[model samples]
Target: MNSIQMDSDPIAVLMQEHHRAAKQLSLLEQAVISINVDGFTRHAFECIAEAIRFFEGEFRQHDKKEEQFLFPLLEKHQPGITREYRNEHRELWSAFNHLLSCVNDVEDGRLRGSSRQELVETATRIVHLLRAHIANENTILFVKAKKLFSTEEYKEFRDNVASVTA
Candidate 1:
């Protein structure tokens, strides 16, 4: 932990956003399992698309900044802990991207020729990965970042979150 006392580290705030994203992701995943997308159910597709877009729009920015700026700072402060966080972030992002790509294929009709099982698998994998990732960040990384960073740091992070939510 850096001796610096930031009001709230941006990482902690971003971690909170991840928790919210995880719940929404779960709803979309449930819809995927329960609904028939290959039947071209427009409403179901729209719901899933909206959720995916929400993640792409909100989560992407948070991750980018965390990976690019906040993460590096934390790594400098605590190499071992930051390494674990960074790895988890990368894995979660990869799974999310992979899952979203499958959804995009279905939306574009490319996945129409495939088994519905593929789509189901994609949804399951994404939901599982995101939930686990959020749990780890919320329980471990967020607390660490909050304790390690100072108030000014927290303010900056909050501003970033506000900009995205707005």
Candidate 2:
């Protein structure tokens, strides 16, 4: 069975979410690495469809939290580093959209053979980019931003995110 680690720290919890998303993305990569999207049916189709839905829906909302809540908090506190941080987030956002498009292509019967290869490559690139983004955000950005927010500020963010996502 699959189990997740429990962490009460708000930032830690969000980082864990990132880890879970990355794991799901990795599973999709492995799924595609060994099969053709159009060729796979039955169980494989279900699995890939679930993965795509999670990435397309859940992860997209998660990105909203970063863009609306987290990044703004960090940018307010650390103007000097905002450029690099925003740049990375922007690129990752674009890559995620591209990955979504590739999955859409597969779902719509446009992906076959080498087209499947392109889809897999696009997904893999998103996974790599997000993994890197999560690492940096957890190690540096989140930690620093936590310092900037008062307990009140942090609590506001925490409550709003939980309410929307729940």
Candidate 3:
């Protein structure tokens, strides 16, 4: 929903969001590396904060668009596919919250020693998980959507996306 236009193709809108998420994940990975080498710094904290903001804000809305509008249609054609994506969504949400908690702890000076290591590990895990999840959606789910939806169906999907995102 960030910069996606209402008139744009819904699949393209989702793909744009995926690209944004990929960038944020990469930033998180870099922040973890920075923390490991130089310990906590403002830059590292900023990276974590940015990622948290994206997860809580734009990313959450994007997921809603998929879950409420996109996924159900896809589910009809591919019964179990939505289940897999939803499970991944839950896992990613949990992981993001955990990482955000760790970031908050670090920001407050409550995190130290092994806790910092744990934070780094958690961030790494999230980055990897999200990248893989995005890949799956881009390659499998989006491809299927393109093939399955009629023009009218795609327009309806777009309208639903606009209604939710607007």
Q: Model 1 — TM-score against the truth? A: 0.73
lDDT of 3 by residue, 22-132 (tens): 999989999999999998889998988898899899999999999999998887777877898999999989988888888778767795768888899999999999999
| Clash count, one per candidate | 7, 0, 0
Q: Please report the candidate that would top lDDT against the real structure.
A: 3
Top candidate (TM-score): 3
Give lDDT per model, in order. 0.68, 0.69, 0.87
Q: Which structure is stronger by lDDT: 2 or 3? A: 3
Clashes of 3: 0
- The RMSD (Cα, Å) of candidate 1 is 3.9
What's the candidate order when arranged by decreasing lDDT? 3, 2, 1
TM-score of each: 0.73, 0.75, 0.91
Preferred candidate (lDDT higher): 1 or 2 = 2
Structure candidate 1, residue pairs in collision = 5-150, 6-149, 6-150, 6-151, 7-150, 7-151, 8-154
